[model samples]
Target chain A: MKNKVIGNTDIVSGILDEQNEFTSVYSKGQAWLNELRIAGKNAFSEQGVPKFKDEEWKYTHIAKALGEHYHLPHTYSLPANQDLSNYKLLDANTVTLVYINGIPVPELSDKLISEGVTAAPASDVENSSEFKTFLGSVADISNHNFSACNTAFLNNPCIINVKAGVQSPKTIQIIHLLGTDDNDSMCFPRTLIHTEKGAYVEVVESYYSLPNSNQNFCAAVTEIIEEENSHVDYYKYEDVSDSTILTTNTYFKLQRDSRSESFTFSLNGKLIRNDLDIKLTAENGHAELHGIYLPNGQQHFDNHTLVDHISPHCYSNELYKGVMGGSAHAVFNGKVYVRRDAQKTNAYQSNNNILLSDEAQIDTKPQLEIYADDVKCSHGATTGQLDDDALFYLRARGIGENEARNLLVTAFSGEALNEIPNETLRDVFADKIHRKLSVMSH
Target chain B: MLNIKDLRAGIEGKEILKGLNLSVGEGEVHAIMGPNGSGKSTLANVLAGRDDYEVLGGSVLFEGNDLIEMSPEDRARAGIFLAFQYPVEIPGVSNANFLKTAVNEIRKSQGLEPLDSKDFLILMKEKLALVEMDKQMTSRAVNEGFSGGEKKRNEIFQMAMLQPKLAVLDETDSGLDIDALKIVANGVNALRDGKRSFVVITHYQRLLDYIVPDFVHVLYNGQIVKSGTKELALELEEKGYDWIKNEVAV
Candidate 1:
């Protein structure tokens, strides 16, 4: 397919030229993997970089945000004894995989000691048949430019495999620290998780930048395959500095009777875009997509999600809420599709936003397309400010203006936060939101 | 404790209160009665510093401090409470949490230490019982899903928690059954101390039957046309506000 050249094609050409050098030096000896990389490169070259003319990229201009100068990752190292305490969301007992500039640091990571589960960097498991079968199968690279770009530069991707009937005892944490002080750097971090039949696993992926780091861009991709009767909970937390430009594409493939729940929290960033796609292929599949994004101070955050129900007796529910302040801009586009074969499917989607300042803006659209006659689908979007009567009511009770505003904002946000299943992790996210709201209010 | 001289107020450039005047000493309960659009609620709102009502030309002194100059929150911190005719429903904020924040903020303004959780819960329990409110009500969001009577009772419950110096009931009896009205009046009666004053603004005289007022003022055309004892309430109730309006016209 011929790709249309749009605004700012310099970034696309630069990335294409860089991919040529990247593949030659990092190509694995495996023929299938090399072929996959070549396919990804060709797909990216065809798609080029998403511009404002693209419907999917209308609200988020990726090429313009990337600018013309950026160096793809070559060699990166973390300083010795780096303080990561602020970045760790869970305790030390949980299995944690740390990645710096898209490369895993095995020495600092915990080995998966649980039975029927294997967690390792892709390089360590590249020869395994399971890794070869599932790496590029779940996520669609031909249609999504960022996913294709991520695939083109995929090197040492994280891989986690869980056998059938295995319920992991602890939550798996994947922490990606992307930044450098030398020059503007860009890295593609890839992840693949496959759970066999009747398996249950929880994964939390969080992104952060090194302290005082220079400009950095991170394009990440994560694909999860839930086999029959399996359940998976996926959470992504993005709290990078203002100098970082991050984009993530997360895809989930659920089989018969499989359940998946995913939460994306875009708390802080300069410019961030998230694409979440879920495909319910077999019967009796369930998926819930929930997210909370708080963008302030000239930041731009865009969330685009799609849930496709293909078989019968499937259900998908999505709720994404945002609180925008300063001159921030946010976009939420949620689409749910129920195919002809997806009889008795139930799909519900809602996106609500609160703009704190006059300059803040939110564009929310909830789209539902159902080809099945016997299905229940609903979609709604609301963008509003804080309730004046509620604020006055609080102040009338003697609460100060700032405290009252915070109270109302927190209440508005708690509707989404309460959906988190884990109590401790919910509290952590709530605290982060509260602290960010306090700063935003001031 | 409260004084208003030539208080003129309005909303959206439409004058509602035209040179209204009234005064009440400490420990007194003054009932201000008038028909609709007579600036009865406007007076109540102006006293509580509601920003929607513009105090065009008004001088209100509470404890000898300029009341109009203070913000609504400061007015609240300084011991003024208005029981809204239609209480705002705030979802997701538990009644107990909202009251706790209010109590602490008022205490902070008074230069006193905030009550600890244990003491605050104990206080809440006491106030809940005083207002005849169920203990479960505190766990729910403020005024959310609450019945009309329960909302009024919640207002009195908040009043009990804050224990303000002056309570302004802005048509608190607007929507309530006899049972709920009695419960609310009982709550207000329980809070009455010798030093606390009350401005019970009501269009109906039925509420005065439960808690007798020391003075009854008939407001007409934004001004008090007549002042008398509790008997004036019964007189107005029997004849309605027509006679008072006629007397003012004459």
Candidate 2:
């Protein structure tokens, strides 16, 4: 606290100082979301940016990042007709949702009208009954400053809805492109995904920053709710520029007999913090949380996941793997909580890390708190280097040193990649990982 | 041809291969038999350019090139191959991909073009019969979840695929049963040509039965204490290593 910036001003006052600017940009017609914004603002005032002293933020230090000055909403304009052909997925039939600076690009979006899926801007449904039930329901911003701040500046939000008993024919691709020319600009992109009973959909969220767009900050909040017997697959790929800082919080709520699988791929960023919370509220709910973070060149990645099993017969499994190189730092804290009434809960969590360079550091902790006696919970964490014997074996087979290391590193991420469930997407991720390795090898 | 002269190497400041000497001519299969801790594997590992083994003093010549100066992979590209006693399991890399990459790397170093996938598959099919390797194993991850005997056979299969000029088998017979040993030996014998050589390092003399060696050398305390014909293996088998130790003492 002694080395604080902004003249001892807390994060709330610093952010709320731009309230008039935010209101002019966001508060147009909707009184409900405006009321929610007031709540979020109040919450941020009560709880400022999380400090290292907080148990949840024990490993990730956000004070320094929050202390910096960032231009909030209404300060930047979207670039015209950006070329994204290179970022498009090849040979896949996908519904593309493009967002620039947290605002949906109507000209670039494609519709899935025949599939009974609605991909539209979140602001369109601000007054709808479904939006009232789904928005901000999964994610709680009461004690979270970043989430609260994101809520307070929510504009041009993305909403995806799947009707009951309808199965999406193609994957939904959401591209969050940051094309801000000015440095130190911040954007809060909100996404709400809701599925009715027996509906199935797969969504991919990709984050990218244009060249020379450094010092940009993005705070994203995504809430996904799966009704009874619904299936949801969510994949997040974070590959921003080195000068950007990204804080993302994704929430998942599963009802009875519903299934959900979420995969997060953190490949490149300056500093990234991801908080994933899953709540299984009804019986026989199942959820899987899997992620792979490959950080190099002074980049830092922190992932904190919480799986709360509040209903009986709920199951949750989490596995995260990371490879750090070039003085990179990574942290993984996975917590599983089975409540007292949640009997027959089965929760498993594992985190494995490989420090490619001696200077690279990794701090991983896997914790499980099961208040119910009938639960089966297990957690494990391991940090180590590449296997010497395996490396030598590959080398002796005429593979070069770098090639051998790349082979082993790629192999290390194979298990998590296999959890993607989709064949083409899995290959895309595998290729991305290989390309990242080649870049690092140089 | 391969040659080693007074090769002294150690690990962690403790000398293992002290004043060792060996020479293998082209077309010859030389069996280097030694008891446990006698530096048989050490000699094999040293020739493979394993960095963990510090060579205190040594000089090795492989096809007139200084073997000591080459990296492990360079040595491999220069037609040297070592079948590890404990084959490492590299998860997520298919056995076929590993062999293809290895063969292509060696071919590239030799200024030869790589084999196309079809040609490589045909070659793989032909070589799979040498060790009776299962076709399914080729598609699975390299050596992951392989049985001990199958792992050893996989080693020989890889040797066949790479077609190294000088192959060093480091206790390839350690974990194999009699039947598996015959399969591995048969595979090795089939690969023997007038232009290639092998340094078979084993603790048991029984492996020498199937892949009959042109020469047998008894290694004692890191040195080749005795050199003789194929009959020398039987002599060592019956008399045990103590006889050689006693003879050296005398």
Best by DockQ: 1
Task: Give one digit per residue, the lDDT tens place, for model 2 in B64-136.
Answer: 8999989999999998999999999988899998899899988999999999999999999999999998899
lDDT of 2 at A123: 54
Q: Scored by CA lDDT, what does every candidate get?
A: 0.89, 0.86
In order of appearance, the predictions have TM-scores of 0.97, 0.96
- In angstroms, how far off is A193's CA in candidate 2? 0.6
- Candidate 2 per-residue lDDT over residues A309-402, each given as its tens digit: 9999999988899989888889999989999999999999989888888898998988888899998888999999989999999999899988
What lDDT score is found at residue A91 in candidate 1?
88
What shift in Å separates residue A6 of candidate 1 from its native position after superposition? 5.2
Scored by TM against the true chain B, the candidates give 0.99, 0.98
Top TM-score model: 1
Worst 10 residues of 1 chain A by lDDT: A1-10
Enumerate residue pairs that collide in model 1: none
TM-score of 2: 0.96
**How far does residue A286 in candidate 2 sit from its true spot (Å)?**
1.4
The alpha-carbon RMSD values of the candidates against the true structure, listed in the order shown, are 1.6, 2.5
lDDT of 1 by residue, A1-442 (tens): 3345444667777877888888787785434567678878888887888888888888887787778867785656777688777778988457898999889998888887888887788667646655778889977888888788888887788988899999988789998999888567888888998999999988999999877778889989999999999999999999999999999999999999999999999999999999999999999999999999999988999999999999999999898999999999999999898999999999999999999999999988888898999998889999999998898889999999989999999999898888888778889998998899998942
